[model samples]
Target: METLLINEQFVSQFKYWREGQVRTGMRFRRNLFEYVSKFNHHQRHHAFDLAWKLAQAGKESIVTATSDSYTIWVNLRVVCPAALPSWSNSGLEVGAFEPASPGLVPLEAVLSA
Candidate 1:
């Protein structure tokens, strides 16, 4: 439901979360959610902030933002419609969420397993 207008800029910067990779969870890092969510305003504010922080810390961060994680957070945000301003568009026309009929029906909802 929550939409992440991952512009070409952000996508271009994210060279790590490419296709066909897997994360096994052998990490021992700080809690990204707590740190960044304290400031950002969006559904995945914590997740997104933490991901960026992890990247800065030089950990194998691309895994933090696998397609699965991205999707889960985005969906949750959409459902809850968090108070984070980052979740919405700015300048009166930010190219982020495209409002739909009530709930956001996932483009791949049928495939969710």
Candidate 2:
């Protein structure tokens, strides 16, 4: 019964905490589901190892340890079509747009200058 509870907890965590992969149909989700189905909670301590395997295969990803409550290791990776925008000089500035402020500058004015 304890193992079942653990498995339930793991599934819940994976479903919600890792929703992105599951929703997007990423390979990681399938791999993890298979792992969970094949092994009990006691034998499923390879989240980091699996992440490492992905990274070693030349995939751009990230891995990190999860909260201490459950498993010792948890990894998260997100793959997008384009990580950044291709457009250059989009006239986006970090500071506020308050015209009254002397030092403040609007991106539009800067771009036009």
Candidate 3:
């Protein structure tokens, strides 16, 4: 699990995401998730970088992994001031398997997402 610290860059990302989500009527854009696999030290890094980006955008993102490492969960709490009244937190879960070797997770995947 990781927590993104709110800062100027984070605020900028947040604003951009929010602005893009606004529509003429009662519609919105879906959150983007551009993910890649990576290794942390020697372990498989199966977490999604979008969670951290969402956190930076004032959306609290919590990630959890089971003991067996077969499943992971992403829980999000969106509290942006520009959001609609009916908006609520979102969650996602994915199944994962251990890799034979390490993998690469790029920063570009997060920025471009």
Candidate 4:
């Protein structure tokens, strides 16, 4: 998810958010679906962990931690993908090294950036 976050930020001024199917087989309806569907297992794990924590806290709106924060919207990731792929369709795991890093990021950090 970190790579994805960076990728998205890197691609930020491009408006590629409206990006359509790279091929003829996939026709994504929403930008958020397209965005999250790209995350790998580690990313998904991190995302689910975050979502679970948010839901557990009784935060009714799962959009962004901040009301005006446009960084990410939870509803998009939570309910959009037609089928979640391993990682941005790249099929790469979050940690390929011998010792994997922790999967979860603090909510404060996620919300901060």
- Candidate 2 residue runs with Cα over 4 Å from true position: 1-45, 69-113
Across residues 1-113, which tens digit of lDDT does each residue of candidate 2 receive? Answer: 00111322223222222223221111233232111111223333443344344445444432222232122112223233242122111332122111222342332333243
Clashes of 2: 0
Each model's total of backbone clashes? 5, 0, 0, 5
Q: Which candidate has the top score in lDDT?
A: 3
C-alpha lDDT score of every prediction, in listed order: 0.26, 0.27, 0.29, 0.29
Instruction: Pick the winner on TM-score between candidates 2 and 3.
Output: 3
lDDT of 3 by residue, 2-112 (tens): 542222121111211233342111101223221111223223243435445555556544332333321211121233444432222232223223323344333234346
Instruction: Judge candidate 4 against the unseen true structure and give its global Cα lDDT, from 0 to 1.
Output: 0.29
Score residue 113 of candidate 2 by CA lDDT: 35
Worst 10 residues of 1 by lDDT: 27-36
**Candidate 4: misplaced stretches above 4 Å?**
1-41, 61-113
Q: What is the TM-score (0 to 1) of candidate 2?
A: 0.23
Query: Each candidate: RMSD to true structure?
Result: 14.4, 19.6, 15.7, 16.7
State the TM-score for model 1: 0.22
Candidate 1 has which clashing residue pairs, if any?
Answer: 1-78, 2-78, 41-84, 41-85, 42-84
